[model samples]
Target: MAQRSRVRCGHGRLVALAVMAGSLVMTGAPGASAKGAAGVRPPGDGDTPMCRLTAGPFQRQVEKDLGLPQDGEQSEQDCAAIRKLQNTYGISPADGYAGLVSHRAAVVDWATRHKATLTGCAGRSRRLVCVDQTHQLLWVQQDRKIVFGPVPARTGMPGHRTRNGSHRIYRRVEKFWSSLYDAAMPFSQFFDRGQALHASYRPIFEDPGSHGCVNLRYEDARRLWSMLHVGDGVTVWGTREGA
Candidate 1:
């Protein structure tokens, strides 16, 4: 049996069933019941909800989210526009979402407030890692161009605020268990004394952040670890200004 979705969305709130805050979980792509042009599942082939706005993934998600009639055809050009929105918002291309047309509009509004500025990283562009604390974003740049990401980040809490200054990656560890906090810090790139850029599973999006570390998602940490090396320059700046 094919499932149908009724999205009661207003003012950016989606009152839908079985949707995670940052992901969409479905047994099959939404509208999986309907077959596409070549009788295929338009966008993705996974059971996961990380939708990338490309030819296959974007179209598939639209079909499911919009319940588009069978035999819908989406051009790569149209998919490219979605990709632009994802990039502009610092959203991962693989972020899963339904009803992309509306989501795209929502992201624009959200990004206007959340996107961090990078111009403060002056004179430190040589193999640099810039952490925008205000927006919880991190990036690796070379020659004034982003090489890796302005990906999501989870920083330290009120008491143990992530240090705000410039430093170098002093160490690298594949698997580190923190004796002080009794937590696991994987793919750690230590810059400050005990603080690091690592992968954490401690509900980073919620309150009370790490003990001064810059925490990233598992995959983001891995990508950073692979791209950065020991002795790379790191700059941490930008306060939340008002509230």
Candidate 2:
């Protein structure tokens, strides 16, 4: 007999779960979604299959740098959160142990590229905002090293593209409301024209793109708020193809 797990959604709908022969089985509401289950994201149909994904490289990298396992036996709830982070951060969404491995691998890649770009920050001023549009990554660098980040970022979507080029932080506001969409922008640092770099809660990984500003995760935005100031160097480089 399989142990049954039951869950209730935000709207009071019920979900029944079971594990049979080492596989997850959900025999509940026909439209059961991850959003309905404990506020975690559902698993994604990943670019790479689980069988093809490997843990060796990511584990070794994490051990060397962060000194942690890529991931060990994660619970359903934990798996949900892990999946959420991977997708929300634009990392690979391989399932189970493989997904965890891919996430770590992504972190290693970002760190390496971000470090290399720090060379350009050499001999710069007090702060440097390096935006690599090709990678959709943003990191704060200072004096030949990274101060914070290599966080996931997204520029404007296809119709309204983010302008590329070196610019300066002309203005900063902790909280700004956009009349264009009535959206909330936090830790906004305007550099080029009306386009700004601010905290974005929008789900870019889900295919919802931005208008023109560089959208960053909330925590990443908060970090920038504490680190950046008006008149800091903001260099936007590369181009997001078909973005």
Q: Which one wins on lDDT?
A: 1
Tell me the TM-score of each prediction against the true structure: 0.53, 0.56
The list of candidate 2 runs beyond 4 A from truth reads 1-109, 112-124, 241-243
Model 1, position 118: C-alpha lDDT score: 43
TM-score of 2: 0.56
lDDT of each: 0.54, 0.53
Worst 10 residues of 2 by lDDT: 7-16
Give lDDT tens digits, candidate 2, residues 1-243. Answer: 211111110011111011121111111111212212322234455553232222322333333333344343233543444344344445443342322233333553546554664433332556788886665677877774687777767676666577777788998878776644546777788888878888866433323246678887788888888888888888777665431
Candidate 1 ranges with C-alpha deviation above 4 Å: 1-118, 240-243
Q: Looking at candidate 1, what is the lDDT of residue 76?
A: 36
Q: Give a tens-digit lDDT track for model 1, residues 147-168.
A: 8776666676566678889899
